[model samples]
Target: MSTESSAATTLTTADLTLVRALQREPRATWTRVGAVVGTDATTAARRWERLHKAGLAWLTAYVTPPTWTVGYVDLACTPDRLLAVGEEVCRWPPVFSVERTTSDHQLFLGIAARCYHAMDTLVTKRLGVIPGVRSVRMAVATHIHREGGGWTVGPDQHEPSRTSLPLPQFWQDGSVRTIVDALGTDGRLSSAELARRCGVGESVVRRVLARLLRNGELAFRCDLAHVAAGWPVIAGYRLDVPADVLDRVAAAVAALPETRLSAAVVGRGNLVVSTWLRNPADTTGYEARLLRTAPGVRVLDRAVTLTMPKRMGRLLDQAGRAVGYQQILPAGGHPVPGG
Candidate 1:
């Protein structure tokens, strides 16, 4: 599979099968993936290389430290500079996802920081001062019910076992950082490749990888372009639920098949969820279904995403396919005033 030819490849059913299997076990061996998807190991490896080189499908890793805080920042930009501002903001390490949506705020951002103070500095001092940014409305997540790492675009396969891993006291090891940085752009890199990059033996790389996963310090997610996967619409909704039932409401909403992100945020509209829909019309149906799931929920605002320039540090094309990568370092790792 040559890189030039791989760039033009179109997805087929076989590709989806491969993707579905990988979604369940991101670092599964080619032999295991081939068995699950009904292909030979060599063929599975070849197909995956094509998909990966084209940026149509890939795996990436993220680290979620216990003290990290997540927030959403809505930026109303000058009408003409929407894309320009988004291009700049999306490159920032702290802003994980940037969406151009059909709301007063033209650009929507998902961000994280080591603490509230870092968050404040990023929003008030950095983002707010961007040349075209007119206003900024920011809300910190009170509790995250689910994140995009758990969402799957294809049919369910057997799920991976997910026992809660114990948090290690010394999770700030240099080897862990090395693994995460390497995996952020290529989560399926071979142990030998990782060992070479980290300047460690293959055995040490394998050991660090196992310990990171076992300690819940690292996560690998299989991501693809939603439009290319058949979900063409990204819908955002804000809801007001009674403070007493916020947790229950968030959990129920997060369970919906279409949900990509669901979190309880700090604002009058306390619950926010982003969903992937087949089309714009499905928005109404999804809303009705959620209302039934949590009757006390009141709709505050809703917007259909026009374009998502970046998702979790991956630059995306207008069609939503991955085009490039940006390393999203953990909160404190990113410098202030820059993100």
Candidate 2:
């Protein structure tokens, strides 16, 4: 499809509702989602298929690395080579997110490694040598108050579940990895499909998936291109919050309508936030609102996103459509070919 067509595409309200339903219940059946979204199962499934085919929306599975430390790194690169550097960096196994931002530091990278030492080596030994890179700043995320997995395109329509499922034991067996690998590209795959890909029986695939979800070993995310969602402007913030009020402030900011990511990191600006804005001009006003609601939260730095080359496993074009995806293995883990 043409870039113009992709960028011009806009999601209808019903489409947004479907996306939100999946965000709430990633593994829920179409029948359940349809009931919640005021539609039929067939209609719900069709809408999702349309969104997925258009590259405007997608669902993927993630297995968090138990031994890895995640860091958000900012790279200042030569202006002329910024885009080149971004495209190259996004493909690195350790880097999962790459964005061009409006700041002295032109590129923002999210890196995951087995430990602090690996992260250090990646920054000083690997990233430092990249041509055109001028400087680098790294912040280890101390706590994740809210991840992108928690953000939804629309308001919550379903009531909170009163009962909690029992957490299952964390499993790192090859079978578990195979299951995760099968679902990495599409989290909504059916039991039959998962079984076919993993070379297991349907019942076994079903059991493994259930265990993974119940134990929090796997996370599913429903993502859409911001431009197609009517929120064309993306902004990032670094806030200096007092230690005593950090949790409270993080929670408050996370609850905002525009927040996509909010976390507490170890750095000069301890609180990092990413938000979607309907208009680029509204950035100052949004900051004002944040200040009003979150008292004593100082804005350390802010950057407006120019382009996102990659998000999660999806490689996006300049217009923000998922043209392809790169397989992301767990940190310090080997790839399970064709799993």
How well does candidate 2 score on lDDT at residue 252? 77
Q: Which lDDT values do the candidates have, in the order given? A: 0.79, 0.78
The per-residue C-alpha lDDT of model 2 at residue 302 equals 94
Question: Backbone clash tally for model 1?
Answer: 0
Query: Whole-model lDDT, candidate 1?
Result: 0.79
Measured by TM-score, the strongest candidate is 2
lDDT of 1 at 222: 82
Off by over 4 Å in 2: 64-67, 156-171, 334-339
Cα lDDT of model 1 by residue, 146-229, tens digit: 777777656542232222333355455767667668888888899999989888889988888888777776777788777766
The Cα error of candidate 2 at residue 92, in Å, is 1.2
Clashing pairs in 1: none
